[model samples]
Target: MASTEAIAAAFRIDPQILEKWLEGKQPVLAKYASAHQQIFAQFEYIGGEWHPKLDRQSSVAMLDEPSQSQNAVESDRVQHPNSSEVDLEPQSTAMFQAVGIVTGAVHLDWETHKHSAIINGSTYPLFYISQKRKAFEALKAEVAATGNSRQRLIVYPRVIHFPNKQRAHEIAFQLVGFDKGQQTKQEVSRELLDFEFKLAGLWQFIPVCRIPCISIFRNFSSERLDYIKQAEPAKKVKFLKASHLPLLWKDAPCKPFRFNPKAEGDQGHPTFVTLKVKFLPERNVFSFVEQLTPVQETAPPFLKASKKDKASLRRQ
Candidate 1:
């Protein structure tokens, strides 16, 4: 499954934006109705729990030639198909849907039986106050009108993200309050309400993002990375590129990693190649292993031909 890092990489946003949303204190992570639908459009639900679909590329590579690979599979079957371990990379840990998440100050509402925050002239319900009531009251008390700064709510999810449209979901969130004078702000992109802007010490939003950076959730998912069955390699030797140095995966920041070699050639070990076979749980870790230098454009060799050559061509 895609991680927050993968999604961020795919959409070309910052990974930390989704990292803040990982621990959902509420049942449903909400998002903007329109943006949620847009995310769903990216993956077709295979069936059952409706796990997001995996395109063929992010798909695990299959070995076609080796009948003996079945022997490798049989050995690996001893290991459980799934793991209880959380991924080291935050993005790979879960699939989150973050869209049009508006950051604002929390104003808990007893009437609505939930907290509500106002943004862009719209009041959206913020869930999780019941569990974090103590923190909620602390926030309310911390910023009481005349303070140096106001409390901030790092709301996650948009209007559209939900289990289903028929049953609307509660938006998950976290409460962050800081001393305005001491606070320093930085972000990849987010929708900050006017007051939040002042709190962030931002005069104007820079790199205004129109699209929401959603997290790819993988809870209770029966899905597993496509099983890779490799027999023990007989040798450890491999080839290396002189210029490329230590063969690299063609990775773009926030893009799917393109490992150099597809898979092990046989029971033999791959040299000078990091087998591209495994679908890593964390995109941020492996994908950012190397930063590729930009390709500098040089005048075409053909164009650099001497005037004598040009005259020769014209005569021909």
Candidate 2:
């Protein structure tokens, strides 16, 4: 869900990185002179503030107390649940996982070219191509069905890192939940990646801290696309792409199946997965499909292409 704007603000990289990305010049970030610390962690709302919660074993998890004041949950400082352990070294792209209560209503935003959700008083983006309308309708249905229960939306994003400015530095020092003491802070220069960074031109502030900002996939699946409900194999897969691969081709980029917030199992949590961006500079276009390597089959490969080539052809 990282929009072009968020990427610019959070990182000290090229302002036109997105444009260059679309133009087929794969943007490579400046490498750190030394190894930088990166954390893959999750957080939860507890005791009127966001707390780091890595354990997923709890069946009856309480993210918010019934009597908790709305102001606390709606605070902009603690809007995100996850934290990072990044340093001042030149930042690179990384992914983080987060869960938040979906606030406000779901609606399409043409400006950002994404469906929008207000999570904890902050705006988050959802990207769905082709069947966007269907996905939007399904999300609306789930939100309405959940009513006042306040369902949680989980997202996985590959975000770019930027140097922490004055505000970000203060927020980093203000955070209170790290398990380790000051020594840990010294070793890993922990900072809040969600803090504001400078954005110019078409780049705007993107609230989601994860993907180039946050987006949906695995946890936020769509029941509308669950046509083969009883089919064990299909159901086991977390996410599904929308197109098919060609013979001798692999790793093609395709849109994911529509999301269904009301799907069974852990009804309170909806999730989404963002695919890694890829490009073909030679072709001057995004590379949706990749050519496969040669196989060592003695006989002619008759059933080869038909085998898994239909990855995108499956009925959603």
Candidate 3:
């Protein structure tokens, strides 16, 4: 079957129009004629609404609730809070925090066209898949121990990939809060700015520094490696000769994953390495003394100061 983009381009119409027709847009039949009707009907029968283009409001509503029961009977059914595209794994009540992965694919020029042509051709198409799996794995263990299935844990993963490097940097900074959080009255602001510039695209920057850690899952299957090798004309991709890759932690020491590279390559699909690296917020212990942090009081303002006292002060 021709890809959605290819089919849409052939019809000289927006892919969204084709999508609308597939979503029971009977009015489109009169506009496009019978041939297009057959095409749309086939799409509905095979693809169904599995690939339905949801509007912003519907998308937001779908994500608002976390503990919605999913109908497991239907294979192509939509689940609230956790769709096939984005999965919200169950986490512990104590560790019940929202985690988001801002993933971007840095593609080679020729491979870019190949991916655009094929629906699932991109290497990082399942970019958020592994991250979601890790979050679920961590949370499931905790939930199993405590027997707290009622607790809601939300994990949102967003994939962003564009050619512009500067825009990518902006996205990285925005996700990490390096741009916004660096605005405090301190001498270390310049150092933070420099760090943001260096680790823009290569590093996946997480917003919440304390709760969740950014983990990198790398698959070295022969097919994937071949795809990478063929995709890159310059041949910049390199394999680690060591069995285990080094793990670097923020504000902590480095610990490496143990594996013999030579032994792993004996198998059909060579090696697979996943590194879970934690990025903690760099805190200057001395700076806490320098800056007088604002105290957040939950009590009403008038409770601390009476209304009559305020009235007397206003009269004066």
TM-score per prediction, in order, is: 0.27, 0.20, 0.19
Q: Which parts of model 2 are misplaced by more than 4 Å?
A: 1-105, 110-112, 129-134, 141-151, 163-316
- Enumerate clash totals for all models, in the order shown: 24, 22, 1
TM-score, predicted candidate 1 vs. hidden true structure = 0.27
Descending-lDDT candidate ranking: 1, 3, 2
| Top-scoring candidate (TM-score) | 1
Model 3 CA deviation exceeding 4 Å by range = 1-213, 216-247, 252-316
Model 1 per-residue lDDT tens digits across residues 72-187: 11111111112222222222221212212234455655564456565444555554322233455665666565552234454333222222223322223333332233233524
- Expressed as tens digits, the lDDT of each residue in 1-316 for candidate 3 is 2346656665576778777766666456466776475454433222221121122222222222112243111111111111121122233121111122222222212222221111122232121121122333444455466664322222222222222322221011111111123345433343333211111011112221211122222222333333333322211111111011112334322121222334534322111112222212232000111111221111111101122333343365
Candidate 1 lDDT trough over 10 residues, lowest sum: 235-244
lDDT of 1: 0.27
State the displacement of the C-alpha of residue 127, model 2, in Å, after optimal TM-score superposition.
2.8
Q: For residues 15-111, could you state the per-residue lDDT of candidate 2 as single tens digits?
A: 4653464455754444611111111123222222222242422211221111133221111111111212111212223222221112233554445
- lDDT of model 2 at residue 154? 23
* lDDT at 47, model 2: 22
